[model samples]
Target: METAQENRLNPFLYLTYLLEKLPQLPDPQDEKALNALLPWSPSLPLICRVFTPTK
Candidate 1:
């Protein structure tokens, strides 16, 4: 049987750890320019589908 402490360390905790380690956001003007310069990517659609609200 799994211990209580081990059970508490779940996937959500790992996700939070990953988010915390990400680089800080850039300036809004630069961010907008970067997005405009970048090509359309399928990553956003995949992530949205993963976290989409279920009916």
Candidate 2:
């Protein structure tokens, strides 16, 4: 059985862990990868915005 403390995970720490484990975003020019991510044709700017990391 899990305790209440074990069930509670820090949001910030969880986000950090997820970000660390996330693979690098594929290049916008890579058609195969972009196709996998988007169903329809996506513009360069859209891809850039989606993949670009926020400060």
Candidate 3:
């Protein structure tokens, strides 16, 4: 079942979704720190389709 929290955030699920993608990031460990600072663009969905949105 989907969590109630996911329902609260629209467009994107939450930062957890963003955090999960950190490991796959191409940047070095040091540079990965800036990942969160990256802008959210249409390319976001390309990272992980799993957490995009059920509906």
Candidate 4:
């Protein structure tokens, strides 16, 4: 992380790298709480297809 800061790495490129490196869990059985943090959106990909429409 220090190296990235020192080298002035591009923020977008760093974000892409971080996304690619993140674990892609198929199941949301243990992710209900985290899922609650993300608001449903038409643009974001349907990761676990667990969208709860607002009433």
Whose TM-score is greatest here? 3
Reference-based TM-score, model 1 = 0.25
Q: Write the per-residue lDDT of candidate 4 for residues 1-55, one digit (tens) a residue.
A: 4443443444445445446534454554546533432333233333423335689
Task: Give the per-residue lDDT of model 1 (tens digit) for 1-55.
Answer: 1321243323444345335433443554566544532223232222212243579
By TM-score: ranked, best first: 3, 4, 2, 1
lDDT of 2 by residue, 13-54 (tens): 434543543355556566665444332223222322223357
Question: Candidate 1, 44: how far from true, in Å?
Answer: 26
lDDT at 1 for candidate 2? 12
Instruction: Report how far off residue 25 is in candidate 3 (Å).
Output: 1.2
- The window of 10 residues in a row where model 3 has the poorest summed lDDT is 1-10
Question: How many backbone clashes are present in model 1?
Answer: 0
Q: Which parts of model 1 are misplaced by more than 4 Å?
A: 1-9, 24-55
lDDT of 4 at 8: 45
Candidate 2, lDDT over the whole model: 0.38
Specify the highest-lDDT model's number: 3
**Cα-based lDDT for every prediction:** 0.35, 0.38, 0.46, 0.42
Off by over 4 Å in 2: 1-6, 24-55
Error of 2 at 9 (Å): 0.5
Give the clashing residue pairs of candidate 3, or none.
Answer: none
